[model samples]
Target: MTQHADVVVVGGGQAGLAAGYHLRRQGLDFMILDADTAPGGAWQHMWESLHLFSPAEHSSLPGRLMPAQPGETYPDAGHVVDYLTDYEKRYGLPVQHGTRVGAVRRDAGGLLVEADTGIWLAKAVISATGTWSRPFLPAVPGRSVFTGRQLHTVNYCSPADFAGQRVVVVGGGNSGAQIAADLALDGNAHVTWVTQRPPRFLPDDIDGRALFDVAAARRRALDAGRTDTGGLASLGDIVAVPPVRAARDAGLLTAKPMFSRLTASGVRWDDGSRAGADAIVWCTGFRPALSHLAPLNLRGPRGHIPTDGTRALGEARLHLLGYGDWTGPASATLIGVGRPARDAAREIAQLS
Candidate 1:
């Protein structure tokens, strides 16, 4: 059925759930559009050995606490899925699962959202796909020649899947290090971490919660033009962490040339060292996945739709969350998504 809502939230992750609740509280009629079959977008596809850097209770949405089982070390991907599923049920958030928004257009009438299913209209649109939307694999020489079973980190689930195989993990990011460590511990595989950039490991928290990168608070300070005044380090600075030292010492990591393209045999590095790895896991990163948005006249560098306040675009209405520092934490987090959702809901309510 073709329907119109006061708001149409894209990417039904924690951000979308939080927005659904806030808008409902304001009595705005809206529907959340998600690519996932259900809620818990990325977590559902996360590495099987994955656990949150923080405790489960700490990562819960605003209204509810993520109930942890006895002796749980933070929440694993499974635990988070349970929590998010429960959140959906508790609030009765309207969701269109398996519906992917293809492109977004704006006009005087309102916002036009095109999805794989059909078209949707709303007073405002929120993009909670987060910065990590697309998996990025660096291009190098002879990429096609690599005759190894290679996969992006997005498809990774469990260490057991790569059991007894020689796996080479590329990239120096948190995901790469964590997965390599887990594969070694669980899969009984020969895991090698090859990255051009060195990585730093975060210290375990007071209660020994493994610290992953939480850059929300730091972004707020940077957005306010205060990065030099002790704000969070930019992307360039995250590499300088001391954890890189710790990871190297643990024999879980190695320094190698930038990934050249695949070769028929295995993989080659920029510096010319090669490994005949059985499997290659790319933990690189992502780009905007809006290949469907072919003609959305958005105003941002690259594919980014930058925003200032809840501004209007060409012909569309938009209250962009995770685009700027509208409220709460400004980083790409639930903390970041929550505040903007509140603002967007309020703006949409007024427009309606």
Candidate 2:
């Protein structure tokens, strides 16, 4: 039988949970639909070595703080997964786990959410589905002809898989840097880091919180009708986490400009030098996960549904949260997502 809710959240990660927290505060009935069989959201899929760049206190959702684990300066993926699980229980948030949302379309009543398990008719729909499900890989020439393994960050699991192999890790973001470091140190792999531009590194002391503050300051400047520099640090600017610092200290963090194209066996540099590689790990990042929203035909050529604040521009009852800066500045991060989530929830409540 088809069910219904006042609002339906399309993701059960930090963003969706944060939305739930605020929805509950407004005394609204909503259900979060998660694709994962268990808790943890996308964190459950990260490579085992991944850890939060920020400390525990700085990486929390609304209404609850993630407790610091002993001896863990920064919580790892497992800790985050556990925290997300606990956060759901602690707040008593109603989450329909394992129900993957297949589509969301507008009906006469409101929005109809079709999931793997059942259908939900909601007065409002919050699309908090983050980008992890859609990993972006650049279309380099000869990419299709390459014989070696090619994997995106979403599929990357551990360095052990690439041990004793020469692997080219593309992208300058934290995922590429962290995975390259892991392969170099833990798996004895010869790793080459490649980026479109030189990777910028924040000071060793700088963390996620500092970056968020910079983003906020830039946002405030923009709001005041002034020029915004977007701060000296961006979310993509690599943080000096312990492993990254260690990699730098060992001279393993050097970055090379992006290769001109992919060759049959490896990549060819702009200088015409070719390196034989057994595998290529692309950390090029992700596009927003809006396939479910495609039925609405609201996406532009860039695959973005334009928004005014948290509300989707064309579809007033539809809200987009936690995709990235386009949805809300710093919305991709844990602490940063709460602002947009709260705002979206309040807006959804008003509609209800």
Candidate 3:
């Protein structure tokens, strides 16, 4: 049977749920298709020790605020998953789990979302597939021949997995720093941090909340045709959370320049020194999981589909949510995604 709806939200993560909240208020019949068997979306796949840098009040979806767990300043991955599970039940959001979408194509009836379970015929589609599944691993020479273990942040679970190993954590972003710290401090792994460039660490006072504010301010400035005047903190800057701070205090947060190439045992540095590593944890980041929209021929250079706000320039009926700031400012974060999701919902509602 082909399920029909006024709007189909792909990827029932925070962004999809946010979009769905508005759609429900506008009396629009919509369905959220989630790839994960559970409700937490990408958070479920995050490393076990992962915790939001911001407080629970700062990280939330559209209608409901993420309730802070007692005695915890920042919620852990499990807390987030629990919240997401409750959020779905609270709103009774129509989410069909385990229905991974294979492709979305145009049809005479409407946009057809072909899934592993069934097909969704919807007038409008909001792609909220956040970038958890598509972890980016940078290409380095001799990568294919590297005999040591290699893993990306997506598959990373815990420091215990790499216990008593020489682990090289790659990338300069928060994930890289956090994971490296975890391994060296807790996993008892001898860890080396690698970066393309020196990483910036924000003041202890600044967290994800402050970062979002800065990004939002930048967006407002750009929209008003003015220069974005912000000091210090940027997206790439690492937050000095407890673990990171402890690591820094212990002199374990130092980073080395990127290696020249991979070796069978480990990596070759630019200085012609080879360091043997038992595993390489690539915390580089993720690419948008937009494979379902490939049939639309909307992808531009760098695998990004250009958008005017959240609406895809190639197809207006198609709106992209939560991929990144390209679609909407801070659309990838819990608090940040609401703006684009609301806008997309309103746009879809107005269309009907």
Give candidate 1 misplaced runs (Cα > 4 Å): 131-133, 206-220, 223-250, 255-261, 270-272, 292-294, 309-316, 322-331
Candidate 2 structure quality by residue, lDDT tens digits, 80-106: 999999999999999888888889999
TM-score of each: 0.84, 0.96, 0.97
| Winner of 1 and 3 under TM-score | 3
Q: What shift in Å separates residue 20 of candidate 3 from its native position after superposition?
A: 0.9
Worst 10 residues of 3 by lDDT: 228-237
Show the lowest summed lDDT stretch of 10 residues, model 2.
228-237
After superposing all C-alphas onto the true structure, candidate 1 shows an RMSD in angstroms of 3.9
- Please give, for residues 95-177, the per-residue lDDT of candidate 3 as tens digits: 99988998999988879999999988999999999788888888889889989899998878988898789999998888998
Ranking by TM-score: 3, 2, 1
lDDT of 3: 0.89
The best candidate in terms of TM-score? 3
Task: Give the CA lDDT, 0 to 100, for residue 222 in model 1.
Answer: 66
- Alpha carbon deviation, residue 141, candidate 3 (Å): 0.6
Q: Residue 258's C-alpha lDDT in candidate 3?
A: 95
lDDT of 3 at 348: 88
* Tens digit per residue, CA lDDT, model 1, 86-167: 9998998888899978788764557778899988887777666654568777776666667778888888878778877888
